[model samples]
Target: MEQQNWSLATYCVAPHVAGTATLQGARLTDFGGLSVPIHTSSTYKVDSAEQGAVLASRKGWPELRKDGSTAKDEFFYSRWRNPTVAAVAAHLAALERAEGCLLFGTGMAAISTSVLSAVKAGDHIISQSSVYGGTFHLFSHYLRESFAVQVTFVNIEDLNTLERYIRPNTKVIYVESPSNPTLRLVNLEHIASIGKKHNILTIIDSTLATPINQQPLTLGIDVVVHSATKFLSGHSDLTAGAVLSNSQDFLKQVLFLQQTLGSTLSPFDAFLLARGLKTLHLRVSHQNNAALKIAHFLDTHPKVKVVHYPGLSSHKDFHLAQRQMSNGCGGLLSFELLGGREDGRKVIEHLQVINLAVSLGSVESLVEQAATMTHSQLNKEDLSEAGIDESLIRLSVGIENVDDLIEDLRQALEYV
Candidate 1:
């Protein structure tokens, strides 16, 4: 047999450790082409009867055992793994600086799986009150009803409040920094410290601040989750989610839930996510720049009663955001139009370039009335408590030219 020499990029950056059963190197050509051919096959074939016997034996044998043999089984099915999806997962793990990563069908799948795997009946969870409405509903309604789990929503700003809410069964503390629609920045270090003291798992929703802008694992968080559909996909072309964790045990548990729940992301979507990730450094930087400019513009506008952007000094969490996040305060921000809900709707209706949409972090600008769109399920009191007012409009600043985005906002605000 001729000895084949593989490129360094593949072995060095590949998902699994070197010499593992998995592919070790990423062919640069695959990325350069920017199109990873999806492996749509449900099953793989064995070369011969002898090869099948060997594979079965490998599967029956543990990779680590008293025999001291170091080997792994080859791929058998797409459900357990796929080459394309594994490659993308490896790349995402590298970006997240985690030991492993798992892709899911959507952000909610990732969140629900993590919570379900980490906590059990009688176990308690502490989370930020001002979270994405879907997440809030998941914790408050489904998790409670289905799993008999207990959750306490607390103010992220007050560490003491979180401490007060902790119970003997509390096993997970989740926080969403620069929380959805509200733009309230939670102190990652503070929450991580609290989790550590209580021997609790710390999970953060990093969708608002993509890994390009912030890495929660670096701040001592036990796990990081993302609505990859929002920013990692960066084009609104695909729906995906990812969960990253440095702990090998935790990763194994997450993977187990992923398999049992059948919430795995399709190989094609995984490939799209990987393609989007290659340009993340560029796209997110552009968005950050454009967002700051727009936020500043909104701050000075007479019709804008308040702007909830971490980039602005007027924001309550501006300094905290400056301390925690690098680059800039991300491209998503919310502002209250002077006239309230009607004014917010008018501005969104008048925008020519910015689309009125529900999801965020796409390349195209998007504006949404948070109270009526993303946070509509919550009652008026809950909305008020979360600082999500009826007049507040969430802006997902795109990578468009700053002047064009500004002019679009100018025309829209005129309607307000």
Candidate 2:
């Protein structure tokens, strides 16, 4: 019952494996290797013009073939695909429990490309106000100015008001769960149901939650997107983004856009991403627990006005979070300090173990005031509309000891 000659990768990434085995990547040769081998060649070799011709036409995820050679696309160029990049995408696909996934150079690249693919010149997109600032800018500014595509930003909690914003031409509904900086929750089920009823696509930015925390696709979302630079690459050493989907047609379209845009991920970074995946479970689990403890600590502090963490019983969305995220709240939380922006800066500047910085989901905690940093220039009114306040201090809980984290915060808050 011996099979014919097969590529080293196919045999190793066989279905039976899960978790770290999948993260370690497919074997490089007949004899399995423990570490994922990086493929740096920008252009792969081809045996014939016919083979080159076949590879040149490939723009989508290659099929898994068993005849040893049927699935091989080891020709043409890396811009279309690379074994290294493909391996990490496969690993993510397995983790997200999706039919397929794509990797891009940065989170914004993935978001932009997907946005381009999902809408046409005249299509309308409905999005929530509470999202990453970059995403908000993309939908509210660039897409509208260049494509003449209409965009609407609404409060997700007011379903009636949100539904009123939807139009007959609405092609998509984009959501960001555990919203950027604020850590607000959007009910995925409600959005998905609206999308289904209206025959629109539902796209969820689940970066903050990570695959360990929640699975949007399972909740009837058409696609799940992530800024893999965060928790997915726990060390924060690499920058990458991912798109996952169950629809072959949508994936194919997005793949075409991905190639045309040419925001391809380099093989070396792809290798780094693969390495990151190996410890994803370990890192996220520890951080998740740490975040809850930190959130609890923030809750009782007299100087803290409000703490935003779904894991906390005081949170407005605790029941919804309990329903969606089975793991834990996640490694992110936000709190407001007593004295507004000045006091927020005092807390951020006073941190020791927690670095005062923008960007998050690293092994070392980061604290930042979103009003001056992440969220674009906006008045108090605009900030309130997005569920973010001038005094909100966003904290990315790291995997550091909970006691140490609490002690660091204690000294930091004394400044307030």
Q: After superposition, how far is residue 398 of candidate 1 from its true place, in Å?
A: 1.0
- Tell me how many clashing residue pairs each candidate has: 3, 0
Model 1: worst 10 consecutive residues (lDDT sum): 61-70
Tens-digit per-residue lDDT, 1-416, candidate 2: 99666443344345534445345554443455665567788887787887777667673346522112224555367887777777677777767767778899999998888888989999999888888989987887789998899988887577445678789899989989888877778888888898998899999899999887888888999989899888888787889999889887888788888889898888788878877777877788888899999898999999999999989998988998999997887999999977898999888988988988888888888888999998865556768988897999999988788899999999988987
Candidate of highest lDDT: 2
TM-scores of the candidates in the order shown: 0.88, 0.92
Model 1, 85-120: lDDT tens digits are 666776677666676777888999999898888998
- How many angstroms is residue 399 displaced in model 1 relative to the true structure, after the best TM-score fit? 1.3
Q: Can you list the residue pairs that collide in candidate 1?
A: 10-25, 10-26, 11-25
Q: Poorest 10 consecutive residues of model 2 by lDDT?
A: 63-72
